[model samples]
Target chain A: MTANARANILSRLRATTTQGSFAVPDAPVIAGLALSLEERIDRLRRMLETMHAEVQVVSSSAWLGALKARLRARGLNGLLYGAETPLGAALEAAWEDDLPPLVPYSESVEQCREQLFHIDAGITTTRGAIAENGALILWPSAAEPRLMSLTPGLHIAVLEAGMIFNTFAEAIDQQAWLQEGMPTNALLISGPSKTADIELTLTFGVHGPKELVVFILT
Target chain B: MTKTADVLAFERNVTKALDDGQLRRNLRSAMTTLSQRRRALFADVEAFEKLRTQGQSIRRRALSRLPELLEQLEARCTANGIQVHWAETTAEANAICLDIIRRHGAQRVIKGKSMVSEEMHLNHFLEEQGIEALETDLGEYIIQLDGETPSHIIVPAIHKNKDQIAHLFHDRIPDAPYTEVVEELNAIARQELREKFRAGEVGVSGVNFAVAETGTLCLVENEGNGRMCTTAPPVHIALMGLEKVVEKLQDVPPLLRLLTGSATGQPITTYFNMITAPRRPGELDGPREVHLVILDNGRSSIYGDPERRATLQCIRCGACLNHCPIYTRLGGHAYGHVYPGPIGSILTPQLEGLDEAGVMASASTFCGACEEVCPVKIPFTEILRMLRNEAYARGESEHDVKGHGYRYTTVEALSWKSWALYNTSPGLARIGSQILGKLGQHLPMIGPLKEWTRTRIPPPFAPKSLHQLAQERGLDDDR
Candidate 1:
């Protein structure tokens, strides 16, 4: 039945469709912002902050120290992270005897359901950032997965300053994620979970992370 | 599920909607904020115009190569371990969704905001099969609880004010105290819908954009309910309009830019979840089984008509609705369809044909505000005029025109014929004016013109015809 339906619709479309090439456009740069990379990153910082998401940019030499200090300030004690990512291994290696235990994402949704909800914060690496929109692009990997960013109360994303693209189009095209087959899920998170459903009034953190704190490693 | 789709009953519905002073106030305030926010966001008029042009070209190209794109999309999605289904009508779409639910034996289904599902009235269909489909989006949840369809696309409960929602919550939920605070109301819904999300065996969502190259379905939402619905459930089923597919991943961002900006003036929505495949092996958390239903409920007919095919470019942003004077004045309810406002005026008829939803074409003021605000630049007013012409030419008055029945009835057709006769002959025009003036003096405001004159005074007929006066003044060419 479904096959018949599919063929019927496709036949209708194909009958009218012309066989031709198309113009694939370049990702246009934002017209007004004639700024350099450094300037764009600064603009991203301000934009994210305006939306109530905290953002900080630091040099790679100071990246680990800055992240640790920020997490401690937020009182995010328990952490679930990807065991195989570069940042994950570094954080695990840096853990001291007195620090909170590091938990790795489970291989299945059911296997980690309990730990996912109980964790105070989850950390992951963003594939890239769109500076113009103040968005962090995170392509879920087997190790990082979807729940790492979704279930935790606080999502702390680590992004490289160089990964920042001026527009989402630039970020998408530059990455060419399709070349290696897209991950199960990829996310472009701008701010914390929010809703204005009730009488059109804005309320933050309804379902996903209540707070999204980004650390940009230069 | 409680559809006001009898566009035939538009007058009664509009009367009821207009009587609710609270609804008017709510719609007025909401529309004002949306428009103001949008204007402020696109302060650089040139930048905004450039994006719209780019967005339009992207949509146009997608349609021009739709079949190949759709075939490629289906194959890619299948390769990604996602099941693909085709639905030629709303009935087929509903049946397909129910079959998926039955396969999963899913008693509880959490639904994200999907206008496609609403177009099929899927919730009611599920209810018939003894399955509970819970709306997870806060706006949708409110409307669901209230037994009403979403009045607006993006803001589903834009029709209800805080006080009304607080009352609804207090009445429906046990232990939910009466409070008009937005945060509190949201918290109450969050607590309720979250439990459903966890309990549901299946999640259903609508697609904002479907990428053919990547087999990725992009779902955009400010509320994370969409995430919960798609992520928490073991099975995720997405229903999309056939026209939502884009040829390339690059095609997505530009269209998305217009969607979020024109929809709510947001730089970006909170979550832009791209589902390229179901949860991969060894993935900790994501839907295991994914299905995508590409639905064509009269969309092919619309596609075949080249001039009007631009209607397919709508991203369902609801910007045109926010800016439309008729929509804001009457609110969505008065339009009497699952979709409403300017887009609905043309779309409802195009998708379902003019017999059922044709009355919507006349609902617009043709102010062209909708076209001006449309992100993809759908020439909405032009389409509305085209639909009107189609309806009149076919004498589709057999379909109800509600309170303004005369507009679509034989009376309207004869009125045009008579006017054509009078215009073609000057003697007939002079005589027609005297007769119309006599009729005007004696007649009470009645028929289709009654609705118009309810709050307006009819202009008195001229004592003499302009053509007659032109002839008398030896200026016959002016006639």
Candidate 2:
């Protein structure tokens, strides 16, 4: 039945003769494509901050310490991280007894769904960032599950400065996303979850993370 | 659910909407803020026009090859392990969804913001089958709670103010406190919907853009509910109008930017999720199964006509709704369709036919504000005029629009035809005006002018015809 329906619809569309072939135009140049690395970082930070997300620029050697300090300062109980990655291993190595517990996403969502929803914060490493819209591109994998940047109340993302692109098209092009098959889910997260649904009042953290803190490894 | 589809009922709804003080205030403030934000975001006129042209061309290209692109999209999605289904009508689409749910044995279905689902009335259909469908978007959730259809497209609950929402939450939710704070109200909804998301067995969503090259479904949302509904549930189903398909992966960014910026004046939404396939092997978390349902639902007819196919170029941004003077005055409820405002004026008539919805085409004032704000540059004034023409003259031409000649009446048609004839012949015109100038004001209010005179004072006609006075003054033939 469905096959017949598909054939009928397609045949109807094909039967109708339309005029003129649509010529696909060349990709227009996007703004902010010519900014320096510093300019790009500045643009991203300003835009994210306007949306109420926090950003901190620190050296790769100091991001973990900054992450710990920021989490402690916010009084978050535990920080969720992926134990399979190098950054996760480094955090695990630098663990201190008095610091907040670092919870690793080691189990399937079915087994850890309850804990994930109640966790204080979850941090994941971003594949890259878009400076034009102030967004972080995430390619969720098995190690860092899709929910790491979601589910938790506070989401902390780690981005290297060099990975920042001036626009989303640039990120897609530089990463060769067309050549490489897209992951099950690819996301561009600009700020924490928000809505202006109630009388156009801007409210954050309606469903996803309330706070999105990015640590740019300079 | 509730529908005000017929011509009389639509006019009645418009009258009632126009009289509602609270609704008027809410719509006025909301529309102003939305249009202001969009203008502020696209402040650079030159840059904005360039993006609009590029966006329009992209949509035109996709629609020009809609069938081929849809086929490519299906094959690519199937290769990516995502099941694709086709439905020629809304009923078929609903049945396909129900079948998917039955196969999964899913009792709880959570949905993100989907206008397509609303068009199918999927929630109402599911309830009859003893399945519960929960709305996860905050605006949709509010509307679902009250058993009301969405008034606006992007913001479903834009017609309600904070105080109304506060009262609603306090009355509806168990042990909920009455609070007018926006943040608190949002938190209450978050808490209520989170449990549903956690337990949702099947997730349903609307695809914003489906890429033919990568077979990806892109969803744009500011709230995280879209993510939860698509990601947390074991089985995910996405519904889309066949027109939503795009050409390639690169076609996404430009459209996405225009969509979010024009829809909510956001540079980008909080989340732009691209779903290529279901959970891959060894994937710890993601939907186990993904299904894409492409629905025609009168769109194929709209696509058949070369001139009318521009209707499909709309990205459902709601910018037209925000800027329309008629929409702002009467609100979306007056239109009495799933879509409202200028786009609805042309779309509902074509989709539902002129017999049931032809009156909606006359709802516009031909202000051209909708065309000015449309991201894809849909010539709305021209389309509305075309639909109006089809409504009155459906039998006059071989047109694909449904319900042609629905509004055509012998008396009205004859009156117009005679009026056209009188204007072309000076002898008949002078004779007609001589009679009208003598008895026009004293004649009984009848015909179409009967309704016009019921509200407005009739204008007095001069005793002397203009042509008579011109000849009395000895004016030349040219004058």
Highest-scoring model, TM-score: 2
Candidate 1: tens digits of C-alpha lDDT, residues B282-336:
7767888999999998787666656667888889999999999988977887887
Per residue, candidate 2 scores C-alpha lDDT tens digits across B105-153 of 9987999999999989999999999999999899999988888989999
Worst 10 residues of 1 chain A by lDDT: A17-26
Clashing pairs in 1: A109-B284
The deviation in Å at residue A102 for candidate 1 is: 1.7
Query: What does candidate 1's lDDT look like per residue over A93-199, in tens digits?
Result: 77754555678885587776767776888889989888888888998888788888987888889999988888887776678776766888989998889988776
**Per-model CA lDDT versus the true structure:** 0.83, 0.90
Candidate 1, after superposition: displacement of residue B399 in Å? 17
Q: In order, what DockQ does each candidate have?
A: 0.53, 0.67
lDDT of 1 at B53: 83
Best by lDDT: 2
DockQ of 2: 0.67
How far does residue B397 in candidate 2 sit from its true spot (Å)? Answer: 2.7
Segments in model 2 whose C-alpha atoms lie over 4 Å from true places: A17-32, A73-75, B1-5, B394-396, B462-479
TM-score of each predicted structure versus truth: 0.91, 0.96
Provide the lDDT at A110 for model 1: 77
